[model samples]
Structures are given as structure tokens and as C-alpha cells.
Target: MRLLIIAPEQIPVPPPVGGSVENCIYQIAKQIKGNHEVTIVSLYRKHLPRTTRVGRATIIRVDGGSKSNYLRNAIKQVKGNRYDLIQIDNRPSFIRAMKQAFPNTPISVFMHSMTFVSKPVTTPSKAALDLGRANLIIGNSQSLKRTLGSKFPAQKHKVKYVHLGVDLKKFHPSGKSGAKPFHILFAGRLIPRKGIPVLLKAVQIARRSVPSIRLSIAGGTGKPAYKAYLRQTAKSLGIPVTFTGGLSRRQMPVFYRTGSCFVCPSQKHEAFGLVNVEAMASGLPVIASKIGGIPEVVQHGRNGYLVGAYHRPEAFASQIVKLAKQPELTKRLARQARIDAVQRFSWTQTASKLTRIYEGHLNRRQG
Candidate 1:
């Protein structure tokens, strides 16, 4: 099969910065190359090689002036290519352009998260309707499917849940068993929606119980003002929190391995917590809020603790304290989490499942 993948311009392929969607595409392309011809259409800010090969797939970088122009140029590029199957990552703005460009081709839209809900309520419903055109819609979690199912009932049959995969080889348990500071790590965009302030408040409470606990935050500030507010809150609370702005994918394993527990306290309806899976694969027990698809990833007492989404600093702090006090339980849960992650969330398995979806679409088109 000849496959053409269209990805957003905000992140590059084999992204220098960390991105789950880009990483997933890179992995799937590499795995499918032995059997299928894969071509990736990526965005370029400045001048780049128009055509090149990354791993096994051919990469085509297109110059897009703005989001609108990018999608237009992408449509133009695909119009000239010969592809049996077309796969596009979630970006609502490109829906109309994609439908117009490849009206006859079997197209599949893979949703990392629904972008339409992020917009204003007054906006027109074209984006939601355009999504219905795809032969298949792949969502990263069951919650995402339910959300889409409610929003676009006509296209419910097209929507299917296929969770993203983590690289087990890259993320695994560190054998270091020495007495270390109770290091807690948080990795994600420092945005208000991510609920970083809630984590900071919980850290303040945790410090009262476990004075030696250390919190390290890794990720760039998607909103600079929010990051500043978090810093001020931490200062006022006298919480010992270190914000490590933006670590690359290579640097993430070090933070994961060193930390006793990984925390993701998002307040929004997260489609799937990719960072949660990454932490599990790293053999680190997670402490997350009981919201969105977080429950699907973190089993309450089996892998780690899940606190209420409401502002319960004491409750959140107690979970951290409990983990700190019981090192054996923490270690056992982390080990089991690692095993579960490796067994269930490998890119090989994800790609194989995706291949079946593509084959199904191809078969339907042929018949």
C-alpha cells in the first residue's frame, strides 16, 4: 500500500521538541516501510529539503505561510501524489481542504484530541461536519470516542478507539536502588488547563508532611503568564518546586528514572494522557487527578493513586506521603505498571492494529 500522512506544522517529524502525535507517526512509518510505501507531508517554517528519507519512509517538507496556506499547500501536494491510502492527524482547519483534495481516496482522520471543543461556542459547525467525511476516524481513547460520538452521531460508526503506543525500550525502570530524595516529576505544557497550579498547591501540602520531598516540573510554558503565576504561587506557599523548562525526548527518561512518582493533574477533558503511559513504561508509579481518560490509564491502587479533581490539597498530599512512607509498595506498583505498559502499549502492536484498519478501508473501497 502507498500511504500519505499529513501532520501539523507546529511540530516537526522526529520532533526536536517532544510531541506524541509526531512520535507515533514516525514509529508507524518506520514499522510499515518493509511492507508499504509511506510518504510524510510535514510543514517547514524556513527553507528545508523538499524531499528526503527519514528511516524507511520518504519525507516531503512543504512551505506553509500560515495555518490556512499550509493546508492549501498540503492539499496541492497530495493532489499530485499517487497514494492508495491517506492518513491525516487531527487539525480541524484542514478538513475542508482534505475532503476537496482527495474526494475519491480512502481517507482516515486520526484524532489525538478533539480540537473543535477548544474553540468558541459561537463558531459555525462546519468543522464537526467535515470530520464526518472520513471513512474511518481513529481516537486515542474511549473517552474521546464518547465525546465524538455525542458531537457527531452520524459519524459514530467511523470513530474507533485505538490508544497510542509507548516505546518500552526507551522507557524502563532504572536499577538505582539507593536512598534518594522523594523526587516527584510533572511533564507537560505549563498551561492553566493542565492544572499545574493544583499540583503546586498539593506540593505545598505534601511539604508540610514530608519536608524532604522535591518536585521537578519539566515542559515549556504554553502560556508565559500562567507559568509566572505558578512561580508566584509556589513562592508564596514556600513550596520547594523546580521548573525545568522544556526537556527533549532524550532528556525525559532521566527525569522519569530519577523520580519516585510521576504526576499529571490536568483539569481539562484530556483525550488520552500520553505522559501517563510514558511514566508507566519508565517504571514510575503515577499520581494523577481522577478526570478525563486518566482513570483508564492509572488503576487507582494497582499502579498508583488517583486523587479527586476538586481542590483537595490535603488529599493529594496524603497520597504522596503514603507512597513516600511505603517504599516497597511504591516499587511493587511501579514494577507492575512497567510490565502492563510494555505488554499493552508497544508501537509494534499499535501499528499492527492501525494496519488492519487501513486494510479494512482498502477492502471496502475495492468491493
Candidate 2:
């Protein structure tokens, strides 16, 4: 099968920066190339070495000014070629353009996260209608599928939930042992939707009970003003918070391994908490908010605790304190987390499932 994948415009293929969507694209493309001809159409923001062959896939960077032009060029490329399937990664603007470009193609739109919840101000009803035109829609979590189903009932049958997978080898437990201060880690874009402020407030309350507690925040700041606000909030509360800006994917394992627990207190709009799976894979218990797809990933009390999404700082603080005081409980949950992460969230399994979806579409088209 010949497959063409369209990624979001933030970065081109072989992205210099780190992102979950980019990483997933790279891994899935590499795997699919073994059996199918894969071509990645991405933005040419930075200089790419003309054309590069990754695994068995050929990555083509298209230069364009506006979103329409990007879609125009992409459709032009496909018009001359015979592709078995077209897969577009999540992006409302790109998806809208692609639908216009390839009206009859067996297109599949993969949702990385909910656009409406991610950006509360923007209404995605029209975008969701555009997405309904696709032959199939793939969501990263059950929560995402339900959300989309409720929003666009006309295309509910087209929406399928396929959980994202993690590379177990790259994100496993480090054997190094030694009890240190209770270190909590948060790795994601520094945005309000991520509930970073909530996590900060929770840390402040937890510190009163466990003074040795420490919080390490990794990831780039999307909104400078919000980042500044977070800093001020931390200072006002007298919480020891360290912001590591951003780290490459290669460096993430170190942070995951060193930390005692991972917290993702996202309020809503989070389709799937990829970091939770990554942390669980690294043998660290997770403390995620009970919202969105978090509960589906983190088994409360089994792998980690799930605090109420709308709870105040005291609630989050109490959970942290409980985990800190109960070393035996933490150890049990962390052990199970490691086992579950490795068994359930393997990239090999995810790629295989995706391959089947592509094959099914191609088979139907041929029939």
C-alpha cells in the first residue's frame, strides 16, 4: 500500500524540536514503511536536506505560505500519484483543506486531542463537520471518541478509538536505587489546559506536610504571560518549583527515572496523557486528574491515584501526602504501573493495529 501522511505545521518531518504528535508520526511511518510505501508531506519551515529516506519511507517537505497553499500543493502532489490511502494527523485547518483537495479519496483523520477543549474559546462545530467527510476517524483514546461522537453524531460510526502506544525499551524502569526526597515531575507544554497552575497549588499544600517534596516541570512555554503567572504563583505560595524549559526526547528518560512520581493535573481537553504512559513505563507511579482519558490510562490505586479535576489544592496535596507516607502502597502501584505500561502500551502493537486499519480501507476500496 502507498500511504501519504500529513502532519501539523508546527514543525516539519524529522522535527528538530520534540512533540508527541511528531514522535508518533516518526515511529508509525518507520514501522509502516517496512510493508507499505509511506510518504510524509510536512511543512518546510526549517532547511531539510532536500529529500531523506527514513527506513523505507520517503519524506517530502513542501514549501508554502498559507494553509490553503499548503493543502493545494499537497493535493497537487497526490493528483499525479496513485496512493492506496491518505492519512492526515490532527489539525482543523489542514484537515479542512485536505477534504477540499481530495473529495473522493479514502481519507482518514487521526485526532491527537480535542480542539474544542484544548482551546476553550474556539468552537469546533464546523471543524467537526469537516472531519465527518472522512471515510474514517481515528482517536487516541476512548474519551476522545466519546467527545467527538457527542459533538458530531452524523459521523459516529467513522470514529474509532485506538490508544497511543509507547516504546517500552526507551521508557523502562532504571535499576538505580536509593530513596531521595519525594520528587514529582510534569512533562508537557506549559499551557493552562495542562493544569500546571493546579499542580503548582497542589504542590504548595503538599509541601506543608512534606517539606522535602520537590516538583520538576519539563516542557517549553507556549504562553509567556502564563509562564510568568505560574512563576509568581509559585513564589507567592513558597513552593520549590524548578522549570527545566524543554528537554529533548533522549533526555526525558532521565527525568522520568529520577522522579518518584509523575503528575498530570489536566482539567479537560486532554485526549490522552502520553506522559502518564511514559512515566508508568518507567516504573514511576502517576497522580493524574480524574478527567478526560486520564482515568482510562492511570488505574487509580492500582497504578496511581486520581484526584478530582475541580478539586482545590488541598485535595491534590492530600493525595501527594498519602503517597509519600505510604511507601509500601507507592511501591505496589509503581510495580503494577511498570508491568501494565510494558504489556499494554507497546508501539509494536499500536503500529500493527494501524496497519490493519489501512489494509481494511485499501481492501474495501479494491473490492
Candidate 3:
């Protein structure tokens, strides 16, 4: 089967730097390309050619100056081609036009978050019509899947879930045998919903019990003013914080391996905290919120501790102090985290599941 993947106008595919959505697209396409002819259409990036073949998949880059130009150019690029399926990542608005362009081909709209499905991006009525055209609507987590279902009850039947995966080989245990400071790593966008402030407050409280506590905040490219605000907050709290300013895919594993533990104190509902899984895979114990699909990744008291009231600093502080005081316990939890990540969440597993889902849907439709 020939599969054509349509990435959002925001980022470029593999070889070029991208966020979670781009990374997922590149990995999934790479995983299934051996069985199917995979083609990726993504926005233009500097120092990369318009068309290039990576492994088995062909990547086509187009001008993404505007959404209209992006869609128009992307459609024009594939004018004379035919495909068994077309996968559109994150952008719900692209579905209707894509469906019209390739009338008979089955189109799958894979949503990473609730952002594109709600608010200024789309209205309920428009979203319903757009999503209704999709043969499959994939959410990265069960939490996201359920939210999408609740939002569009009419299209609920089409909604399904496929958890995002992390590269095991790339992200593995880098033993910090005698590292001085106990690093609490947080990797994600510097958005309000990420709850960086909560983590800072927690770190401040935990420092009362464990003086060797420090934070390594990894993520970048938002308003600089907000980042400065975070710096100010950390200073006021008298916490030692290091902002790595967006580590690359290669740089991430080093940071994870060097850290003592990973924390995800999200104030809002995370569809799926991909970083938690990545941290687990890197042999670091995860301390994350109990909300959303986070619980599914970080098992409470098993691999890592899950703070119930994520917004409250005390809840997270207690957990942090627990891990800091008990080095042996932290190691044990880290071992279990690695085990869980290896046994449960892997690219091989996610890829197989995705492949099966695609086959099941397309085969059923054909039959």
C-alpha cells in the first residue's frame, strides 16, 4: 500500500528540527515504510531540499507561508499521484479539502492534542463537518480520544487511540553514578498549562528537606517575557534552576540520563505526556500528575510517584523529598521505569499497533 502523510504547515519532517508532532510522524512513517510506500508532505525548512528520500519514505517540502498556500501547494505536489491512505497530522481543517482532492482514498486525521479540535482553530459545527469526512480520527492518548469523542458525539464512532512511542535505543540509561546535585528534569513547551511554576514551588519546598536539589528546565521558543517571569519566580523561591533552552533530539537523552528524576506537574489535562515515556525509557523515574493519560505512563508507586493535586506544590514536594532522601528507592523506581518502558511502551509495539489499525480500517472499508 502507498501511504501519503500530510504534516501541519508549522513544522518540517525528519532531518529538520520539529516538535512532538513532527517527531511522531517521522518515526511512524519510518516504522511502516518497509511494508508500505510512505510519502511525507511537510513545510519548507532551511538547508533542506524540496524533495528528498529518507530511508524508504519520500519527503516533499512545500512553501508554508500561509495555510492557504500550504494546502494549495501540497495538493498541487501530489496532483498526479495515487495513494491507498493519506494521514493528516494535527490539522483538522485540512481533512475536508484532502478528502475532496482524493475522493476515493481513505483519510486518517491523527490528533496529538485538543488544540486543533477546539477554539479559534475551528468551531464545533465546522469541526464536526471536517472530522465527519475522516475515516479514522486517532488520538495520541486515551484521555485525548475520550475528549474528542465527548466534543463531537456524532464523530465519536470514528475516534480511536494510539499512544505515542519513544525510541528505546536513542533514549536509555546514562548512569549518573555520583552526580552532585539531584536534578529534577522538566522537558516541554514553556506554556502556562505545563505548570513550570508548580514545579519551581515544589522544588523550593523540597529543598528544606534536601539541600542538594536543583532543576533542569528543557524546552524553549515561546515569548521570552514569560521565560523571564519563570526565572524571576525561581529566584524569588530561592531555587537553583537551569534553563537548557530547547535541547535537540540527540541532546535530550544526555540530559535525561544525567538527571536524577523527571517531573511533569501539568496544571491542565495533557492528552499524552510523551516526555514521561521518554524519561522512563531513559531509565529515569517519573514523578508526574495523576491527571490525563499520564497515569497510563507513570505507574503510581510502581515506576514513579503520581501527585494527585498537581497544582499544589506540597503534593509534588513530598514526592521530591522522598526520592531525594532515599537514593536506593529512587534507583529501584528508575529500574522499574526502564523495565515498564521496555516491556510496555516501545516504537516497535506502537508501530505494529498502528499498522494493524490502518490495515483493519482500510481492509474493512474495502471488503
Candidate 4:
């Protein structure tokens, strides 16, 4: 099948900087390349190539001044391309325009996250109407589907859940456990929503029980003020924090392997926690918030523990202390995490699921 995937203007398909949606698309594209003709259309940035091929998939960039203009130009650029299915990522408002552009074609809108990311100008009813036009709507998690279902009951039947996949080979056990001087790892954007400050507080509290514990942060800060605040807080608490800034995809696995445990203390409502799975894949016992779709991945007492988010650093601290104190429990959870990650989350499985969805949509359209 010929497939056209439309990504948000903020990032590219291959994603120069780390992005969940882009990485998801890249993986799906790579996995389905042998069987399908895949093309990713993204907003043009001066730094990115106009057109390039990654394996069997072709990435094309379109020039425009604004977000609206970018979408318009992207649609214009792909006007003549023949595609069996068109899959767009998390943009309900644009569904109507895209439908008008290709009236006969089957289009599927793949929702990667929550509605906050899209921020569509249209009303709820209008957005639902736009979504109704699409042949299918894919959600990354059941939490996303439930929320989207409540928001747009008219299109609820269209919603389907497909858990995001992780690269099993790249992220696996480091073959060494209970390393000396236990380290806690946090990797994500250094923003308020990521709960970086909360992690610092948790580290401070955990250190009383586990004095040898150290915190290592690996993520780029979009806001300098927040970064400053985090550094100041860490220094004030005398907590040893190492900020490695942003890391590329190639460096992520090694970073995760170096840490004894992974913490994702997000304050915001996460549609899904990709980092939690990645950490689990690396054989690290994950300590994430018990909110949103996180529970779907982190099974408490089985693979990892889920604590409360926000200002409750003590909850996180308790978990960290527990893992540090109990070496046998930590090793058990880490082993289970790796086994679960490999069994449940694989790009090959994701691609196969997506392929079946694509075929079903195409068949329905043809019929």
C-alpha cells in the first residue's frame, strides 16, 4: 500500500531532536517499508533536507510561513501523489480540509497524545464532525481513547488503542545489577510538567536512607529559568545531580543502562509514558506516577512501582529508598521489566498491528 503520513510542523519525521510522535512514525515507517510505499510529509525547516529517503520511506518537506500555511503547503505538495491510505498524527481540525483534498481516499487520524498538543481552534462539535469524516482514529493508549471518547462520542467507535512499541535490542539488561553507589536516572525535557524539582526533593529525602545514591538528569531544557531553578534546588539540598543536557537516540540506551533505577515523576497528565517502557527495557526498575496511561505499562509490585505525582516527593522518595534497601526486590523487578518489555512491546508487533488496521480500512473503503 501507498501511505502518506502527516506529522506536526514543530518536528521532522526522523526527528533531529527527540520527539515521541516522530519516533513512533519513524519506527512504524521502517517496519512497514518492505511491504508499503510510505511517505512522510512534514513542515520544511531550513536545516532539514527538502526530500530524502530513509530505507523505503521518503520524507518530503513543504515550505510555509505559519502552521496553517505549512499544512496548506504540505497538502499542495502531495496533491499528485497516489496513496492507498493517508494517516495524520493528532490534528482533528485539519481532517476536514484533508478530506476535501482527497474526497475518495481513505484517511486515518493517529492520535499520539492528548488534545492539549493539537489546541484546535474549532469547537468540540466541529472537531468531532471533522474526525467523523476520517475512516479510522488510532489512540496510543486506552487512557487516550477514553478521554477522546468522552470528548467526541460521535466518533467513539472510530477510536482504537495501539500501545506504542519500544526497540527491545537497543534497550536491554546491562548484565550487571546492584552496582556500587546506586544512581537514579531521569530523562525528558527539563520543564515544570516533567517534575524535575519533585525528583530533586525525592532524591534529598531518599539520601537519608540511601546515602550513596546519586541523581543523573539527561534532557534538554526549553526554558532556561526552569533549568536554573532545578540546579539551584539541587545545590541547596546538597543533592549530587548531573545534568547531561539533551541526548540523541543513539546515546539513550547507554544512559539508561548506567543508572540503577529510572524515575518519571510527571506532573502533567501523560497520555502514555514512553520513558517508563524504555527504562524497563534497559532492565531498570521504574518509579513513575500512578496517573494517566502509565498504569497500563508499569504494573505495581510486579515490574515497578507507581507513586503519586505533583508535590508529593516523599512518595517517590519512599519508592527510591525501597529499591535501594532491597537488592533482591530491585533485581526481581528489573528482570521482570526486561522480560515484560521484550514480550509486550516490539516494533515488529506494532508494525504488524498497524498493517492490519491499514488493510482493514482500505478494504472497507474499497467495499
Model 4 TM: 0.93
Instruction: Give candidate 4's root-mean-square deviation (CA, Å).
Output: 2.1
Tens-digit lDDT string for candidate 3 (1-367):
7889999888788634337898898887777735688899998988789998877789999999999899999999996798999999999899888978999999999999888877787888888888988999999888988999998998899888988888999999986576467889999999899999999999999999999899999998569999999999999999899998888888888889878999999988889999999999998999999998898898898999999988899999999999999888999999999999999888767777887888899889889
Residue-wise C-alpha lDDT for candidate 4, range 47-121, written one tens digit per residue: 888998887788898876777888898899888778898999877667777888888888889987765324465
Query: How accurate locally is residue 73 in candidate 3, as Cα lDDT from 0 to 100?
Result: 95
| Model 4: colliding residue pairs | none
**CA-lDDT, candidates in order:** 0.82, 0.81, 0.89, 0.86
Candidate 1 global TM-score: 0.94
What does candidate 1's lDDT look like per residue over 71-111, in tens digits? 77777776866788888887655666776777777778888
Segments of candidate 3 deviating more than 4 angstroms: 15-18
Model 3 RMSD, rounded to 1 decimal: 1.3
Sort by TM-score, top down from the best: 3, 1, 4, 2
Candidate 1 lDDT score relative to the true structure: 0.82
Comparing 3 and 4 on lDDT, the stronger one: 3
Best by lDDT: 3
Q: Which residue pairs show collisions in model 2?
A: none
Candidate 4: stretches off by over 4 Å: 45-48, 116-126, 308-311
TM-scores, one per candidate = 0.94, 0.92, 0.97, 0.93
Instruction: Show the lowest summed lDDT stretch of 10 residues, model 4.
Output: 115-124
